[model samples]
Target: MPTTEPARPAHHFVAGIGAGPANLSLAALGEDLLPGGLPLFERQPGPAWHPGLLGAHSRLQTSWVKDLVTLVDPRNRLSFLNYLVQTGRIYAFLNAQFDAIPRVEYARYLGWAASELGTVRYGTAIHEIRFADRFELVGADGPVATAEHLVLGLGTHPEVPPCLPPGGLPGVVLAERLDATLAGDSGATGGQVIVVGGGQTGAEAVLSLVRRGVRDIRWLGRRHWFAPLDDSPPANDFYRPAYQRFFHNLPDDVRHAYVGAQVLTSDGVSLETLQEIYRANYEGYLRDGRAPVMILPGRDVVRAGARDGVVTLWCRRASGGSERHTAHLVVLATGRRPAPLPLSAGLAELVELDGAGDPIVDHDYSIRWKHAPRHRIFVQNRGRLSHGLADPNLSLLPVRSAIILNTLLDRPAFTIRDEQVYTMWA
Candidate 1:
């Protein structure tokens, strides 16, 4: 069946390009402040924050207090706490005693907020955005809606390495499809499985295979060890507004160096997730006399291929040697790259690009464009170097959205009061 076109509002004050958590955060914050409202244009039929990757044991790395509106507007009606209260799940949620909320529960919280806002036009795909007196959001079907301002939150997608064959190998799959692919004769239970990447997704993928009775699994990562996320106070200060403010004022080289130095803080697996994996492996060993998962750190999978019933992976070890591993299925959890923005050629020509042909996002998250003064194009999750690791971190979602809102609204819509700060960045 074909996807039917949903009705658009004809026009909006701000036409958010994607309805992911970033734009959803914007809609949550700047909806009332804008003239008409910051409505979202989502390609998906419904609200789903990483629907495929929400494993049974996945938990958020950030705190629950870092919700859609709390850090920026705690009194906002669409807060996670408010969602809990309105849905009659507050007491039940509190009773669970979770150090970190389940990723599924956070997704549900986002969906609930999206439902309450009712500002998202789902199933509406924006392919190319062209600029005129205003911006026109063009969809696959046709030009859908025009807006005075545009915000890009296209979000990220699974990154399958180039070493893999085109369209992926026959039995090879991304980490998100591991479970379903396992059911399809991809050989999950009967043979060894290969999981690439050491991030949270890869960790979950390895654990999932163990749960599914896969006795042999090779978990490969480029790091010296499977590092855990540094969620400590000084480390978290790297996510604060004070740190961002200081970091932004530094030279580009310094900012880049700082981000490179602190990659694990934002990108590493959760400590709890690692502990679970170790405990599960220990239990499996006690029961079956053989550990289910083989944790191979310092191995980077540089090439992969599939033939007959086996998926072969050629990894480049950090200590400078190559090794091969053949498995029934290869799960590529190699992290995600940001989805390409739908900027038209004309719009692209107008926007300033960095040396690498990426957008030159400023301190305020606005892309430096020719018509930025009159018409603005703000982005989310596209600035890790310019901004810090907090550019894409969920813990700073509301704060980042608040910064963008303040830029878009041309006034301080939300006051970010980060007064009590002891650490001073040199």
Candidate 2:
């Protein structure tokens, strides 16, 4: 059936590209500040944040206080707390006493907020964005809307390693589809299952396979060992607004070094998650005489291929030599990169690119373009190099939204006050 186009306002002061948490945060914060609202065009039919990746036991790494509006506007009606209250789950949530709330609850909170905002044009994918006197957002049919300014919050997609076949193999599935793929096929987990990628997602995939009674599971990682997340106080300072401000002012080389040195802070597996995997492995070994998950760290899969329903991975060991591993199924839990912006060639020509050929994002998260003075093009979650690690993290969602709003509004609409700086970057 053909889907009906939702009614649009024709022209907007500030329009957003994607309705993920990034743009959702922008919309929630700018709800009252913008003349109408920072309306968003989402490709999805409805509100969902990483729905496929939200496993039953997966808990959010960041605090729930860092929700859409709480960090900036706690009193906002679209806050997580308000969502809980409205849904009559506030008391039950508190009584449950979780250190970190389940990822499902957070997804529900976002959907609730999106419902209350009522400004998102769902099922509307912005195919092309061209700029004339005003930025024109075009969809499948034609020109969807025009805006004075645009915000890119398209988020990211799961990345599969280039070692694998371009079109993909017979049994190779992404971590997001592991559960469904396993459930639908009774023999999917009958033989050796290899999970690639050393990050938190990979950890979760291994654990999920273990819970599903898969006896042969090989968890491969590129790092020396599966490291725990650096959740210490000093490590967390990198996520603060003050540190973000400080880190941005440093030289490019220094910034890159800092990000590389502190990779574990944002990219490592959660301590709780690691412990749970170990405990599960121990108990499974006691029950079945052999461990279900084989923790194979320091192995970087350089190449992979499939032959007669069997998958073979060629890996380079960290210590030195190369090795081969075979499996019936392979789950790729590799990291994600920012989705490319759908900018027209003419508009892209006007924008300045950095040494890496990416857009040069300013301190306010706006791309440096020819018409940036009058018409700004802001980006969210696409500034890890310039803005530090917090750019891709959920910790500073509201903070980033506040900063963008302050710059877009051309006033101190929201003051980003950060105090108690114990560590100096000098």
Candidate 3:
């Protein structure tokens, strides 16, 4: 069904694109500042959270405590803890004694929060964003929505290897939306399955296939053994207020290097999950007498081709040996890049970017342009280097939202609403 076209207002106070957690956080913050309520546009039909890859065993890599509202304002009512309480799972979860719940659970929590806010405009895709005296948001199916301030939370773009042909190989799925892609057919049950990459997604894919009773699976990667995620807890200090101050003072080059060094490229699986994978593979090998899964580390795929339901991959090994492997399916666990902004050429030229083409944002998460006026056009997720390592992570949702809100309202000492608080005791 089509959305009822809102009577286009002369100008809205604020507008946000892509209603993911980051922008959702900003929307929550806006509720406090704008009694009239800010407008939000989402491309998806509803408050869906990565529906494609909503796997049964896919647990959140980050702690639940790092949800949309907690980190910045722990007392926020729209918190994961609050969701648990509302769902009557607070005691059940406490009894389970689990640190992190499944990713699907988190998605549900986000959906609940979104439902309560009632500010999001689902099924509304902003085709192009233009900034002049005011920000113009052209929708795919409705009248253009204009706002004094705009926030882009378009999210990350999935990265596929150039060697792979467009449209992707049949039976070969990029690990972006695993559950949706591999819904009915039992994975690897028909024949051998190959999973590429060495990130957390790759590892998770391999494990999921194994759990699905798919015995013939081969895991290939360019690196030897899954690289250990930086487990040092103290490193989190960089995300704190004091560290943000220190990081902001560093030179641009230094800041870039620092971020590149610490950011988790793949899903940071917990120690328990890591141990489960090891145990599952080890025990299966010992009992079945057939090593259905082979980890070919230090190998890179040169090319892949599919013929007659068989997908063949040509790879170069670290030992200077070339090998060819065939599989019934191949899954790419490669990560995502930043999504393209729907800005006009002229407006895009006005926004400043780093060497990598990422937006250069100021302290308040507003895109910094030599000619762009301050507080007129704001950005949410495109300021990783400026904000610190937590910029894109769920951990920084509240902080990013607060920063964007304060900037939009032009208030240096703005305070978040106390009702939204999710206290530790609560």
Which candidate number has the best lDDT?
2
For each of the candidates, give the backbone clash count.
Answer: 0, 0, 12
Q: Write the per-residue lDDT of candidate 2 for residues 1-426, one digit (tens) a residue.
A: 999987764898999999989899999999989988988999999988887788999889898898997887889888888899999999999999989999999999888888889999999999999998999999999889999999999999888888877799988999989989988999997889999999999999998888888899999999999999998999989888999998889999998998999999999999999999889889988999888889999999999889899999999999999999999999999999899999999999999999999999999999999997799999999999999998999999999999999998999899887887889885
> Which model, 1 or 2, shows the larger lDDT?
2
Cα TM-score of candidate 1? 0.96
| Candidate 3 C-alpha lDDT tens digits along 76-179 | 78888889999999998899886668888888887888888898889888898776677788876645688867778888867887778988887778776555
Q: Which scores greater on TM-score, model 1 or model 2?
A: 2
lDDT, candidate 1, 59-171, per-residue tens: 98889999888987889998899999999999999999999999999999989889988889899988889888999988888789899888899899888788776677876
Poorest stretch of ten by lDDT in candidate 3: 417-426
lDDT of each: 0.87, 0.92, 0.74
Best-fitting candidate, scored by TM-score: 2
RMSD, one per candidate, in order: 3.4, 3.0, 5.3
Task: Please provide TM-scores, in order, for all candidate models, with all chains considered together.
Answer: 0.96, 0.97, 0.89
Q: Give per-residue lDDT, candidate 2, residue 288.
A: 92
Residue 255's lDDT in candidate 1: 84
Clashing pairs in 1: none
Residue 186 Cα positional deviation in candidate 3, in Å, after optimal superposition? 5.3
